[model samples]
Target: MNHGQTAPEDRARPLSVVLAGGGTAGHISPMIAIADAVRRSRPDARITMVGTPSGMETRLVPAAGYALETIDRVPMPRRLSADLAKLPGRFSRAVRQAAEIIRAAEADVVVGVGGYVCTPMYAAARRLRVPIVIHEANARPGLANRVGRALGGSVAVAFASTPLGGADHVGMPMRREISQLDRAGRRAEARAALGADPQERLIVVTGGSSGAASINRAVAEFASSGRAAEAGVRLIHITGRGKEVLDPAGSPLSAPGYAQRDYVDGMETAYAAADLLVARSGAGTVSELAATGTPAVLVPLPHGNGEQALNAHDLVSAGGAILVPDDEFTADFLAQTVAPLARDEDRLAEMSRAALTSGVRDADEQMAARVIAAAEAGRGEGRSRA
Candidate 1:
């Protein structure tokens, strides 16, 4: 609870929440969704974000209208090359800075998502006696979240298949915009808002929030070739603010049948507009696609033991979507895979059902309520003013 603020339920106290984690949208998006959920239940809950300056969260968190406190930190390299000499010093500074940030937030609870920076971030919160919670988005635990669980209230997760070691499954926190799609008879209007053509199969492409260079390259190549245009597909591509150019002016895919934006403002409408979706298999994307029942072709990031591949395979094995490895991606393959699927109304319908089956629609509310319960339960104590 924040100083002298009372909870509406009992007029007793108001809670403050501190979220620690984010390097990618996969990590940061969930935190934002959870914060929104927390706000809905307890409007008085104050929220702040703590993140390493090295990642996109530094830009994204502030962009979402939240203040970001920066700490100098990086994740441990997966391989131990000789350059690890900087680890100890950097880790020490990050912990100290993170601890200071916690003290400043006057936070009642600290939530850790993903990323190596989480180690020091949660360490500060734990040592400061703030209630801690971890939200794990993957079906499998990341090494950081696995270790951080000891310091958490419960491991909130997106997928039912995730291994959380007896932790409660609070589902993935989806952006509130997605839950709006649950309203009756909004699909066609939502689709029209994104400017879908009445005669063509609407296809939306995203390379994750920061943009997938490989996916972007592939889509740009495909879009430039006029193949998508020939196939009568309307395209909406999110560039994630990395590249300035999407295609040449005279390119075949550069026609009025397409709209390209660096950042997506109406993601819900994009989902509503898309019949066949092409995207990265980030947990947040996977959950969003599932919730919106949008059929997708998932291209997992090929590096790092196939984390994204594993996620895509989970959906594929359950008949939700197709998994195309990055190495297998090309302009021709993308056109052949996406174009036909877009035209096949029955396939789109089936895939949408499969995707819906994979969704945890109420994840945000479940996670928020759980975290708030813990925060309330732990609120008998207060932070030391020292």
Candidate 2:
């Protein structure tokens, strides 16, 4: 009955797409966006997600209304340890599990978005002679994606500066909400919905779904010091789930313009309401900020392969974002640097322009097209083999 459903003629042929990625929102969100795009273009397409059982993908993929097949996590060890000793067996088992899932799905093509589960999935897809497409979110390619590239998969990178071989700069595939958001047109409504004053400049601070301790502490300290209010900017701070709650009642700076929440379900509203942002430079966060033309002060997470720092480089260099080292993102820095930046309307407007110039609004569609082409090519190859 749905008008979007495939017509009778188109019902006979449907492509089976298997998307592999997980562990983090950076990987999973893009995967879902691409999948959504594929469904929009081909209503009869059968799409499934492959992820680790314990990762965030378990919830996110299913919540996005896609069937998810999960395998055990098999992280590649860097040094000789007990886990390294078990790597051979664990990896073999994971690959076998992945291969079985691929076979069951009868995947026309396998697409990887780069996460812990991708290594096994990539190996399995190769073994099955299935065409593989990879999307790397970070400027620095992860180990799984690097391995996938070595396996000769079609590669797409979010940043032009990503050093992956044979990579096409397709940009990060964003959620439909973000990709289609009309920030300028909807700003008033969005702010009103959030109970934020439409006339006041707003600064939104976030640290993904798991919250960053240092960011929270620094922002809280700045707010408590009354500098944020003095700067003539309202604040919307989203401390990640299960993190320490910042109490406004305890602070003299708890003005009507300041609001805090543990999580924001409608991120589009948050993006629309914000003139500036202060947050960790995760690949997803950076991409979204750029796409929305929301100027940012990015604090790269100190751990990992330093990929967060790399992720923020292009935007920072474009004058759309400012990258601050984790150690330097203190309360004093917020007071001295961020507070002044928020008050400068001319600079914020220029940064917003730069952010839009650095972003790609149609990346979801672009990635979907690539995935569909690979699927068609794979199906043609299958027929030829038969």
Candidate 3:
């Protein structure tokens, strides 16, 4: 044997972790946050991510400086259809692809944040004897995460009411910027960065990454009403990609004290700059609001499984946020509710404190520790088998 050669038994394997989640920022953001946490704690850890080939992860995971593997988008049908007839073959192929990735990575543990790829990844991990850990970001668990939980994994949830049995009630994992933000200290800087008037209270409105047409229309109408300007408020409207409101002249809409952007790269600065927020109550948004103590007027999406309403319920009840029905979130609602709320310094401060009380800033570190522990346990099991 070569002098440089070492026995396999003497070589220590670095921790191998495979994370799966994608499609929406809600899933992918937390997945990446947790991955960052794991790396901070275990620098030698080899981390890989899995997502559907068509999901947002194709762009985001690579941008976050992590290796990503893709599989087919195997959506389980809620109702029988032609797609359902083709599900078996598609799912089988995806599972095989997932298993191959896991084997090639020598993944000691699989952590799924909930998405289309998660069901197959969970199944493959189970078949491969790799330990699984799950983080469910919504109050109502999704089908894939529910399946993962049933298949027996350590489960964590952003909300205590998530109904994933035995799930540890860990809050949502957020990127370092949002998690560590000192809103008060950075308020002036953040406002300056966004080009807001330092003396005026700023309201940041976002419809999440994909944008919301109704919210955009309502904000444009509110801008035309001039109520926000009259109240000495400034507005940063994140209209989402391709969803900008336009005037009769086909130019983007404009009003005094109103600024519009299709997107903001770092939402933490937006959260810091806002005295008030108007946005949908996606799990990620709610958690970030609470974390940064940015009080919000939340408009839940009218469609979907009604999880958005459920996601905002606790924060609204906590007096940290307000919830309005989608159809009722009109210009008048903004003038009467959000604009006035923005101008009320004392009330805004109270809501900010309440939001902070409801937030969890350490979930990323907490989830990372849990994931690493699961991986270590799997390593123990493998050594025992050997």
Task: Give lDDT tens digits, candidate 3, residues 309-384.
Answer: 9899778888999899999999888888888899899999999999888889999999999999888777656532
Model 1, 1-386: lDDT tens digits are 56534345433547778887777778888888888889889998889888887888988898888888878766686577764887787778888888888777767778888876678877777777777788888777887788678765467667766767867766578777785475225657766666665556788888866788887777777776677778778777777885543445643335445667777666787787677888888777777887877888998888776667666655677677888888787888877778888889998888888877776678888878877876765565544424
lDDT of each: 0.75, 0.86, 0.89
Ranking by lDDT: 3, 2, 1
Off by over 4 Å in 1: 1-11, 77-86, 104-106, 182-194, 213-226, 229-232, 239-263, 380-386
- Predicted candidate 2 versus true structure: per-residue lDDT over 231-263, tens digit per residue: 787888888887755466643235445677788
Candidate closest to the true structure, highest TM-score: 3
TM-score of each: 0.83, 0.92, 0.95
Query: Which pairs, if any, clash in model 2?
Result: none
Score residue 88 of candidate 1 by CA lDDT: 81
On lDDT, the stronger of 2 and 3 is 3
Q: What is the lDDT of residue 206 in candidate 3?
A: 95
